[model samples]
Target: MTKRIRKAVFPVAGLGTRFLPATKSIPKEMLTIVDRPVLQHVVEEAREAGIEHFIFVTGRNKAVIEDHFDIAYELEETLQKRGKLKEYQALTEQLPPAGATSFTRQQAPLGLGHAVWCARELVGDEPFAVLLPDMVTMPAPAQRDRCLAQCIEAYATHGGNIIAVEETPWEEAHQYGIVSVGKDFGRSFEITGMVEKPPKGTAPSNLMISGRYILGPEIFRILEKGEKGAGGEIQLTDGMKTLSKHQPFHGVRFDGKTFDCGSKLGFLAANVAFALTNPEIAAPFKAELQKIFGTL
Candidate 1:
């Protein structure tokens, strides 16, 4: 039987250098989209996917991220005194039980692989999931699972390193780590190999890796060596490629629209996209957007 995937590791230690001055104090994960911070959206997706224990591989100056999931007692009490029951419930509703969550530090700004390696001890030998907070995806209400949830389904069946992949235009393959596909499985495929930003036409396929992954524990051993690649950082892609040689490696092409929140333009696009769907602001927001676009 396949081992149940109960824990998830979120690597959110990057110093948001791309959005520098604003990120100078606040961790990028805490940046708000619509109303909640970016990390909240990732956590909510993990929860929806039946991830029981949330493990955040965080870094320096990220205490606020930890606090975001904890009970805000004073605020709760104030809400109670003011008879704002709805407000109080909203704050505490999504927070995981205290013991169900864990935070471990990624002491250096090494890379994605090293950041994931930071939580190795906490994860132990279980199959785990990794959701990159930078890529926030939204699926239509009619769709069953978001990207990560679908990735988990792929893991439960294939039981190895299964990552969420999406098709990009062949010409833009150089912008992302591309995957060479084999044995098409309808919903997923056997990931023959991965190319980190393959040179234009040199890319084997247009299928690019999305930020959600379900990895077997053996990948930890590979990441521990900490060898640097692509920008002198320990790349998780490197570790996954090594693990794929020995373990079953596959990819799940998710059915959702992923928003890249790592860049300023992507961030702004997500906010607008989210707001347009938000009931509270949808009407006014659409009118305002039309007014602005008309003037432009």
Candidate 2:
């Protein structure tokens, strides 16, 4: 029987140079997308997919990221004293039990592949999910579940690895790791090839690799021998490419809005889009937008 996927690794070691000054002290993953931090959104998605063990591959100045998941005793006690039980419940709702989560430091800024490789010992021979906290998908029941759960299901059924993908414009497809698809499996496709940031107009397909992934343990071995690609960083795409040669690989077309929180424009857009969904803020935010546009 296939070992059920129970663990997930989150690579949160990126230096958010894009968000600069603000990120000087704060880890980008701790930045909020509405009310919750970006990492919270990623963790909720993983939980929905039945991931029980959460492992974070952290780096310098990322202590806040770990504290975010740890219990805030004073705050919880204060809320209880004030009869803000709902608020307190909300905060602790997603808190994983002790030992269910682990943190390991990625001593160097190698790349996604290296960060994941750092968690190899904890993962220990089991397939696991890799969720980059920098990406946030809007809350949509089936769509949210589809992104993570579907990847895991595909990994199980296909007995290999799976990456979440979504369509991108052909011209801009080169900006991402593009997937060469074979047969369609409804919401996903069999990945025949993967090209990382190929030159424009030369990409295999327009299906861009999104941030979510369900990887087999064999990938740790591939990553161990993986060389840096595209940028000077050891790209996860490079490791996955090698794994594909020996095992089945597929791409799930996750039905959801993915905001690239790693970029400024994408982050601003996500904030606005998420705020517009709030009952209290939506009306005021819409009015402000109208007034600003009218003045322009």
Candidate 3:
């Protein structure tokens, strides 16, 4: 029987240099979209996917993230005194039990592979999902859970690692890790190989690897010796390439919309999208947006 995937790792170690000043003192993961921080969205996604253990790989100045997940006792008490029971309940629901979550510091500003490696102790030998907090998957009922469940199912049937893929513009495909498609299996594809950010005209296919991944524990062994690749950082793509040589690899095209919250435009877009979808906030938010844009 295939073991159920119960743990997930969120790599929140990035400096978010792109969103400066705001991120100067605050970790990028703390930046909020529609009142909830990006990391919260990621954790909620993992939770929806049946992830029981949350592991955060962090770096300096990221304590705010830990605090965000902790119970805000004073705030909760204040809300209780004000008789805002629903608000208080919603706030408390966001706080995870202390021991249910773990944090490991990534001492250096290395690449994705190094950040993931920093959580090896917590991950141990289990199949785990790795989510980039900078990527916000939209409000699908299952969202990250659906993606992970699909990967878990695929892993059981095929015995390989699964990476999330999404179709991108053919020309822009070169900007991402492009996958060479083999036989299509409806929601996923058998990956022949992956080419990392190939030159504009040389990309193999339009299926770009998104930031969500359900990898086997074998990847940790490959990551152990993972050499620095493009940009002189230990790229996870490089480690996946090495692992592909030893085991079967597949790419699952996730169904939900993905927002690249790592950039200013994407962040703004995410905020707007989320606000529009939130029932309590949607009406006023839309009215304000219309007033501001003047029917543009």
**Which candidate leads the pack in lDDT?**
1
lDDT of 3 by residue, 57-156 (tens): 9888889888888888899999999999999988988877668899999999879999998889999988889988988877366553545555566767
Model 1 steric clash pairs: none
Best by TM-score: 1
State model 2's lDDT: 0.88
Clashes of each: 0, 0, 1
Q: Say which prediction, candidate 1 or candidate 2, comes out ahead on lDDT.
A: 1
lDDT for 95 in candidate 3 is 76
Candidate 3 wrong stretches, greater than 4 Å: 139-146
User: Which tens-of-lDDT digit does each residue in 181-241 have in candidate 2?
Assistant: 9999897789999988999789998899989998889999888975888889899999998
In model 2, where do residues sit more than 4 Å from their true spots? 139-146
For every model shown, what is its TM-score relative to the native structure? 0.97, 0.94, 0.94
Better of 1 and 3 by TM-score: 1
Worst 10 residues of 1 by lDDT: 152-161
RMSD of each: 1.2, 1.7, 2.0
lDDT per residue for candidate 1 within 94-208, as digits (tens), equals 7997699999998888989999999999999988999999999988667878998888788777877898988888888899988888888899889989878777789998888
